[model samples]
Target: MAKITLKDLSHSYLKTQSSDADWAVRDVNIDWEDGGAYALLGPSGCGKTTLLNIISGLINPTKGDILFDDKMVSNLNPVERNIAQIFQFPVIYDTMTVYDNLAFPLKNRKIEEDKIKAKVHEIAEMLELSSTLNNRASGLTADGKQKISLGRGLVRSDVNAIMFDEPLTVIDPHLKWILRSKLKELHQKINRTMIYVTHDQTEALTFADQVVVMHEGQIVQTGTPVDLFEKPKHTFVGYFIGSPGMNLLPCEFKGGDVMLNGKKIETHTKVKSNNFSKTEIGVRPEFINFSSEGIPVKVLSVSNTGRHKIVDTQSQSGKIKMIAKTSEDIPSGSAFLSFKKEYTYAYGDDWIIE
Candidate 1:
């Protein structure tokens, strides 16, 4: 396995453009530790796939360099980089048998037939395909085909890194969970550097030890799943990570008081009188308490999702929503909200902190 580094990386489609809009991937510098599992997460067209392709060497960047173990490899081809990539859908030979499909990579490299057979059998067993080793791929189910594709990538231990680009899209919702957990288990057993790309937050959080959040061609944040849920560093990050996301209220900052629509709200952070004229106060749904005191809200809708009830409400300031467990009862009419001081974050414009 190798440590991956991206140095001042920015890629644009045009020949020579300097603006941010022209670039597919904006300036980014990050180091992915050796043998670590990482997931690139973001909405569609946010450059997550582009970044993955760049790292895999399927596409070249317009500028900057990529390094594997401190050696520059931005120009290397996919095969020369020693990277194994699994696509969104299964990429196996339908005409070939499951065993042959898994054996293709090893045979292509002129490895000994006995060794290839042993390795293929081992990977097939790991994928639970040992019983169907001789089964033709054309007759297998989608999930079975995908398993073959996964086995193909994992059959070789000489690969520098294994990359996956939304490899669970075609999978059934229930099977997706099982496959994700299995992938995590496999990662632990093999200890290979793996980078996965996905737009789904649940998939990203469950599979990767670290997640890289991208927005509009730039990486907004990189952190553990818990770090992102509890403390988001950007307004977009706050608006994107959670189920209902976070509540953002524009406020006036002066001294220790946070003025919202001329009313001062209590805060955990110390603020100077003239520090920042205006900023945004962000709090998660879990941090906002629906109490008898504080700002009042009108309940627009309430949805019971088994374990919790997601309450959609509207306040004088703007739209506000909160989640309450099914066991907890919400007070009827003009429900009040109490913000958790310690859990709140202060932001200047869209960026958090100061």
Candidate 2:
């Protein structure tokens, strides 16, 4: 495994463009540690796959350099980078058997036959496909075929890094969990550097040790899963990371108090800004709840998600939602809602305080 460094990386699909919209990927500088597991997470057209391709040597960067273990690999081809890339769909031979598909790569690399047999057996058993080793690849299910693709990628232990590009897009929901858990277990056992690219938040959160959240071709934040959830650096991060996401209400920060819809509430801030334009207050629905002496809101709709009830409401300021444990006595009429200051965050123009 190698420590990957992306130094001043940027890309533009348009040749002669002056504005930011012309760029596909912006100036991104991030250092991924050796043997670290990372996920490139964002919505579509957010440059996750572009960054992945640059790292894999399939596309030459329009600007900047890529370093693998301190060696410049920006201009090198995919083979020279010693990277394994797994795509969304499985690529296999219809004529070959399951055992042959798994053994194909090893055989091409001229690995010993006995070693290939042992390794194939190990991967097959781990993937729960040991019984179907002799089955023709064409007869296998879509999920089974994808498992072979994954096994092929993992079979090569000499690669510098293994990159997965939304490899579970075709798999079923139940199997998705099993595969994700298996990948985590495999990473723990091998300790190889892995970079998984996905637009799905759940997949990224579960599979990555550190997640790099990208938007509109630029990386917004890179932190542990808990860090991304507990304290988002950007408001977009706040809104994009969660299910219903974070509630960001436009407000003004006036010293120790935050003003929203002519209502002032005490908020925590170490230092106040003089020209804090577009100031907003953000709090997760989980942190805000119904209380007697607080801002009032009218209940709109309620959803019972087994564990808790999500109370959707309309307030004087705007819409604000809350998560309640039980639906008992929860009024649909006008009621008051309060935000916990400890869990509250003040933002200036959708940017968090330093």
Model 2 lDDT tens row, 1-354:
789999999988777769887878889999999888999999998888889999999888789999988989898998778888889888888999999999988998899999999999998988888999999998988889988988887777788889999999999889888888988998998899999999899999999999999988888899999988878878888989987788888876666577888788655453367477688888888888788878888999999898888889998778898888875557879998888876678888777765
TM-score of every prediction relative to native: 0.92, 0.91
Tens digits of per-residue lDDT for model 1, 110-178: 999999999998998899999999989878877888888889899988888889889999999989988
Which parts of model 2 have CA positions greater than 4 angstroms off? 107-115, 255-257, 268-271, 274-277
